[model samples]
Target: MAVNLNDDLEFVDDDYFDMFEFEDEGFEVNRLRREGNSAGPDDVEDASKQKSDTSALEYRKGKDMQGIPWERLNYTRDKYREMRLKQYKNFQNLSRPHHGLEKECKQVKSGSRFYDFQSNTRLVKSTIVHFQLRNLLWATSKHDVYTVQNYSVMHWSSLLQRGQEVLNVAGQIAPTQKYHGSSPRPLSRVQISTMAVKDNLMVAGGFQGEVICKYLNQSGVAFCTNLTDSDNAITNAVDIYQPSNGSTRVMTANNDSYVRVFDVERFVLLNRFPHSWSVNNTSVSPDGKLLAVLGDSTECLVADPQTGKAIGSLKGHFDYSFASAWHPDGRILATGNQDKTCRLWDIRNPSQSVAVLKGRMGAIRGLKFSSDGRFMAMAEPADFVHICDATSDYYCTQEIDLFGEIAGISFSLDSEALFVGVADRTYGSLLEFNRRNQFHFLDSFF
Candidate 1:
């Protein structure tokens, strides 16, 4: 029940729109125009200055945070949203009734702006390799962000307003460090499907079941390996975390119906947990005792990390789930589904979800909880990201409406900055938002 982008298949859906092709055409047109109108030194300098001015981290009172000029585009915001909803097709592996999903959803209270939009910059363009995957972006700090752009993993520094290439997977890359039990073969042109960066270590999963690891402080890739030899192999998600034993580890969910764990230091396999369905995503609890496994089934399982024993099962979703996250307190768990809803469950109760949050127009592809456990963010497939207040039982929320497919979402370690990746060729950029706290008063004093 997993979708393989490597297959060449025919489609029959009425609303099937080639959005990626459209975006590519737009990018080509822009490139040709820029080449035709070659500017002199003065014009080039002025253009560069203009781009810098727009890309800076500035907050204007009445301007749109996304820099989308709806009035001048000959279409209103509402009309564009209507068109998207009518044309957008949600991908599903299982046939089910989707029209009745709204009946089970709870309407979230709107107009609570806990985070203010700080900037929208086109300098750092984020690209998506697979449309169904949205786990490519990560923020190591408030000023540092990493995302996929074509074949490169790019690092963008908000403080300096510049970008640098962290790792280029376009060329042949072989692991420099050799492990005893791991196969060391040169991998070329790996199509990365998902990635995670934490505590100076970055790990990326590929469409061909390759796991690539690199240290930010080091020069080259530390380790690389292919997890499976199956034809339908795809690494769906990668989670980098520390266990209770204080050892760093990496967990990956794959389309092979296995959740594989690897020791970070030795780059060796630690454990492999088999599931009934193709595992889409996995998140370990804060205490590192419990694991949440979600995939092609409507029911999600709570399992043990060390042993592959099922602790409990949560059932409420009518469609497959693609994303999961644990609150810092390790009590509440959130899972995003193709049913256009994100369900929050209390692990202690495990009977039903405590809250059912609905999306605006599409599937909830990504979810993240702030480090302080104060806010939870849910991202749709495109054009919507919702921030829910954790203290208010998730009733109060703020909706961030934008244009483009979301590559991913991440919160800084300090819970001060939120970064969203937009993957459209024309409107592709990284969006940053800052928490609305009283600490900004100190900025004026400085």
Candidate 2:
């Protein structure tokens, strides 16, 4: 076939060789043949055909894994990343300066700025299932607070920056004594409806017409007694009072239409006063001479603590009253009513209310006054608490948004902090607010 190699290898233009090349239309067949499919002309074409089929199968398989489309998998990954980023942003927002911080200040209508301090949200793990906070009290020591929910009394300590549950006193019935004849069964459960704390003593009244007293520093119950004949009776309110000349006493208002006074030392029934309607709340005067009582009626009654005699009545509320608070000087009284208003009464003028403070929503359920007689706080059923300045005729005020069912409110004995109790399953908390003032003259005197 090759007679003379030099004669066949003649010089030719490079453009002439380029014109003889073929364009690839199917899977670059000739390139695959050169790489691995080296065979005769007919076999080469068949192998190229088979390789093209396999390449098409692999291309389709690359579009998905485990029957899911590539587009869908990318979308799921993007969504998860977005959710995680959003969660991180929310956590960062909580740490920023907001209304719930202790040093945050709010501007009032009068252009005066005041600081609204809030502690960390406290959660009672054991009482999370209960949706109602029946009563609340601040201990003589300003660092502790108590709450009554269902059959348990919870003690919260605020010694640290954040408040936490320290102790819980759960009610239990005593075993019946052996008797010759048949005896009735004692109550198996007692639901505490009201509570009061003084010094080391804690007294709670139950819905089963029972009163249980316990010592805060001790373990066991101090005393337990059934105050009413019927088991269905409710103790609406319990108050601890210290007279000037006598020892400490406990006063209770019950749904059985009676107010009873008990000696804290002896746990004996001292006196009982029968009222026309069920008493909802009662507060003894600071002088220990008169008692301010609120009941089912619109009028609030002033009674003698020693004799239980009705001295006079303060009228003017449009609806039934639920809570009452007395001024530190014993000259003024505030009664909260279902009419969404709190009425202020002066003992000197028993015929009419001195002032009426309105709420945004729901009835007024709780009332408290600072020990210095400077501020008065009224709590509505849900989402609102009003702190009014008593020195200005309650004209200057600040509203605190709690955003839950408010069970009770109390001011510290030193007039430094205010405590609010929220009674919700998910949002239940004890909120503590500090009073920030620029002046220190009164603080030095105290």
RMSD of 1: 3.9
Name the TM-score of candidate 2: 0.68
Model 1 Cα lDDT, one tens digit per residue, 1-446: 46646532111121232232233213433444587667565565455434332432334544445555455566777787788878777776667776666666777789998887777777677766666679989999999999988778999998887799999998899877877776556788888889999989999998888899999999889898789988767899999888889899899999899999999878889899988889989999999999999988999999988886898999999888999999999999999998888999999998989889999887899999999999999999888999999999898999998878889999999999999998765556889888888775544432
Query: What is the TM-score of each predicted model, taking all chains together?
Result: 0.89, 0.68
- Candidate 2's residue-wise lDDT over 1-446, tens digit each? 00111111111112112111223223445665667656567666665434322121233345211112225333553453354334321101012232321122222243222324435243431121111223555545567777754446667676643333333334345422332332223444665566778778887776556676677776656666677875335677788898666689889887678998887666667899999887878999888988988876767889898889999988776566778889998899988876667878888887867777877665677888898999898887655778988888887788875444566777878878787776544334566676867762343342
Q: Give stretches of model 2 more than 4 Å off.
A: 1-115, 125-134, 161-171, 174-187, 439-446
Report clash pairs, candidate 2. Answer: none
* Model 2, global lDDT: 0.62
Clashing pairs in model 1, backbone N/Cα/C closer than 3 A: none
Among all windows of ten consecutive residues in candidate 2, which has the lowest summed lDDT?
1-10
Best by lDDT: 1
Candidate lDDT (C-alpha), each = 0.82, 0.62
